[model samples]
Target: MDGDLVVDGNITDVDDGAAALIVLGNLRARNIYLAGDAKLVVHGHVTAETFVGDMTDKLVMIHGDLRATVSIFWNEFCPDLVAGTLHGRTLAPAYLDLSTAPIGCLADPAPEAPLSRLLAPELLVTGAPGPDDLTEIGIRGDALRDRLLGGLPLTTTP
Candidate 1:
């Protein structure tokens, strides 16, 4: 239609001094709006369906499908945004697959899961078939939200 643009990746650093960086080397315009100030050094799996910016241009980091619509700046780059990011609409699109599914537990994990950069083919956690024993592969929903945030320890209740 007229609202299906996407931006892959770019902007290595430019929080200030005028701002105006760009990247998203593909998939353009889903009512997009990423302003400027460059700073997307995540490299590897990159994606973007739609998202606008503030906080000096994406300083609200939370890499992994930033379905930004209009305004949602929490600073410190996605400060564990349990209720932020998702402006205009069309949430979830920063790259996901958790190997599949509703992304088991709503994605956003990762503490130290490097499984050799994974590519499928059984993600055995460690040695004698790990992952607490095994049987739950096909993970990708942003790496099962970074493995459901293993180690779990980032408070902010209220």
Candidate 2:
């Protein structure tokens, strides 16, 4: 639960039924699969190094930040953010359920620089020059993941 938790195999705890697998430290895994109704609750943070098993699994919830280097294909990607931040290099806007995903804060025109960097850039898009009814943008999750991995933070600039 401390250092790096390298899970080279599979994490299948789909029968827990809402139970939380809380981790005190960071988690480094290659492939993760959450089935049934179990919830993967991490207190520190999770770093999926290799690849995520699936993205449709919404049972994986993190209290801390999540850093992934690969593309996570999901029907919808919306993490239950408590106090931590989101750092996916390429998790694009198109994969987000804007209706439920908290992309940007309308309250703050420009969010804090530090906090913005820790989160995905795709979450900052509003109404661009496109379809008026456009709800999602086609952005790559790996791109955002790379930026976060490369230590590039999201910025508010023209």
Best by TM-score: 2
Ten consecutive residues with minimal summed lDDT in candidate 2? 103-112
lDDT of 1: 0.28
> Candidate 2 local accuracy as lDDT?
0.44
Model 2: per-residue Cα lDDT over 1-158, one tens digit each: 54446665445453534566667666766434443455666666676532232234445556665655432334344444434545444333464643445532111123333424533455333344333212343334344344444444323331
Note the Cα lDDT for every prediction shown.
0.28, 0.44
Report lDDT (Cα) of residue 28, candidate 2: 69
| Residue 108, model 2: Cα distance from true site in angstroms | 19
For candidate 1, the 10 contiguous residues with the lowest summed lDDT are 149-158
Q: How far is candidate 1 from the true structure (C-alpha RMSD, Å)?
A: 15.1
Candidate number of the best lDDT: 2
User: What TM-score would every model get versus the actual structure?
Assistant: 0.22, 0.45
**Model 1 CA deviation exceeding 4 Å by range:** 1-4, 7-13, 20-76, 79-115, 118-158
Tens digits of lDDT, candidate 1, 1-158? 12232433322232454553233222333222333454332211223322323234443233234432221121112322212223222222233222242212233433433333322223223334434332232222232223222422111111
